[model samples]
Target: MAKLVIYLNCEDARSQAAFYTEALGGEILNMVTYEAGPWSDMPEKDKNKIMHMTFTAGGVLFYACDSIGEPIQRGNGAFFYLSFETEEEAYAAFDRLAVGGEVIESLKVQFWGDLFGQLKDQYGVIWQIAVENTSPSM
Candidate 1:
């Protein structure tokens, strides 16, 4: 099976990882600075930036690093979608992610029979949270 990992670029990847851990519920697996290795050729400022970091949240893997050239932009054609097994879990995540972030859509049952909502996090990342509807049909 193939694996998909989201690699994000941030102004301060180290701090971003911390915020992600607190908001998204994850543990940082590993982190590396650019002081050495292939990134040694980088400038002193870039050397201290996060070269790479791995985090795991709800069994999902994520990678993040600081940009070497152009900074990251908020404009998007993509966003992360998190699916939950229970409505409570979905709601809790939505609430937590909404702190200091913009809620594009409040959480609610949708026409598709699922609880869904969208938000843009403080880090400029967009997210869509959903939980399958288990209620019986009327």
Candidate 2:
């Protein structure tokens, strides 16, 4: 089986890593910064910026880095969905993710018989939290 890990580009990868840790209850595994020697030609402002960061949240490893040139834009037609097995767990996670962020939709029982919600985090990263229903009938 193939594995898929989400990668994100931000203006401040360091801050993003910290926020993810707090909001998603994860830990930062590793972080790399752009520096002299191999990055001599890069812009000065980006010299201290994060080159790469690896974090593990909810058993999933996510990768992030500072944008080289392009600006960081949220709601880029994508969302990172975090699925939970229990409704309580899903609601707790969703509430944490909504702190200081905009909630696109409050958590509620969806038409598909699942508890679902969407929000954009403080760093402009969109997320979807869900707990699927195991019922046999719709």
Candidate 3:
């Protein structure tokens, strides 16, 4: 089976990747700047920009890169859903990701008996965090 990975295009991939690493308690596995890659002939301004980056957090892996000579159009069609085994983990991650961003929904017990919340990160990415209730009254 083929593996699925999330790839993001942003204005500042390096800063965005760093923010995610800190917020999600993950590490940047690999990163390459345009100047360091085959496209080393890129303009000076873009040379320092990230050409590619790989990071993992809470078992989730992601790829990101800076847009090359193009405008980024952010939409609300997709979001990253994260399900945790514990409320502590879910809450901590939610809080960290909410910094400098908007919280669509604060973490709380939903009708489904799970602790859940939604937010847009500082980098304009949406995320949904949840913790399933081990013992649901239903």
Candidate 4:
């Protein structure tokens, strides 16, 4: 059986998914545009809006979706991304995510020999994204 997947919620689920997909070397797995259907209860004008989106990036399953009502308050309370590749991934991810949310720390080569950074997505979910400068021994 396939493993369970995780997801992130945002104001524009599709846009957020796209942002993460670009940053994490991932693609939009699926998208649900709230159009004239049950998924979209809003007016026809809002039909083109994205209700939800998912992606598979960096071998990890990521999820995102738009906010239906009062937006959820999110923050980088205390979470970081642990990576296993070159600093490029960290740098790229930071650049992509920064499009929507604020960057608390820019991604850069760390003295400890790794690329690391932190930021909040459009939805306010705090994450620690990083990529080890050293390649792991097979």
Candidate 5:
């Protein structure tokens, strides 16, 4: 139905959004910038900034936005998961992603017969990549 994501406010929202779009092959639905406040009551700063953005990748819809006013407290939330169809795909992606990051876990035979690994990307986003060995229908 719906999904949500939080994006840190970086100096360049457009560029950051593009990078993520390319990396995940997600659809960049909207990328717009408007002049500050003469038109709306909201602060002018936010007008030129990315107030919000939406993307759809791999059959999933995700939302992102620029952080405002404060530093985001990192590493206090649940880990995010990304799944690959095959173990090979997962390891390949894991290697590519590890260029600026380190592999928290090298691909290995998981207790469930699938291979899995954990990593924190260059941008500080932690992910758990895995292959599903068991059928969900069971």
Candidate 6:
């Protein structure tokens, strides 16, 4: 089977990874600095930047890295969709990610009978969180 992993490019990958771990309840599995990688010849100012990082939360896995010398353009075409088993989990994640960010949809029950919400995080990453209906419909 093929596995798909989301990759993100940001100005400060270290800080981004930390923020994601805190908001999404995940641990950074591995992080490599530019200086520690093959790019040791990079400028001193960029040497300490994160070259790559691996993060996983609630079975979701993704990678992130510093944009280095390039510009990062935030896009609105895509967003992360997180499904939680409980309302508390969904609300907690929604609240955490909403800090310093804009809420596109508040967490509440939808017509489909599930708690859902959407937001753009402080780092400009959009997310949609939801809790599936646990009981059968009439």
Alpha-carbon RMSD of each model: 2.2, 1.7, 1.8, 4.3, 3.9, 2.0
User: In candidate 5, what are the lDDT values of residues 1-138, reduced to their tens digit?
Assistant: 864664544545565556555555667787545443255665656667766666654445656666556655557376657788877667766775565776777777676676688887666667677887775433
Greater-TM-score candidate between 2 and 3: 3
| Model 6 Cα lDDT, one tens digit per residue, 65-132 | 99877789899999899999889889999999899999999999988788989999999999999998
Return the TM-score for candidate 3, rounded to 2 decimals. 0.90
Model 6 TM-score (2 dp): 0.90
Evaluate residue 52 in candidate 2 and report its C-alpha lDDT on the 0 to 100 scale: 83
Off-target runs (Cα >4 Å) in candidate 5 are 1-12, 32-47, 135-138
Best by TM-score: 3
Better of 2 and 4 by lDDT: 2
| lDDT minimum window of 10 residues, candidate 2 | 35-44
State each model's CA lDDT, in order. 0.85, 0.85, 0.90, 0.68, 0.64, 0.88
- lDDT for predicted candidate 6 compared with the true structure: 0.88
Estimate the lDDT of model 3: 0.90
- Tell me the lDDT of candidate 5: 0.64
TM-score of each: 0.89, 0.90, 0.90, 0.65, 0.70, 0.90
Q: Could you tell me which residue pairs clash in candidate 5?
A: 9-67, 37-44
Angstrom error of the Cα, residue 100, model 2: value is 1.5
Candidate 4 lDDT, 1-138, residue by residue in tens: 887667565667765666666676778767777783575357765687666666886678876666555766765455646575666655666777677788888777667766778787665767778876565432
Candidate 5 local Cα displacement, residue 27, angstroms: 2.4
**Model 5 deviation from the true structure expressed as Cα RMSD, one decimal place:** 3.9
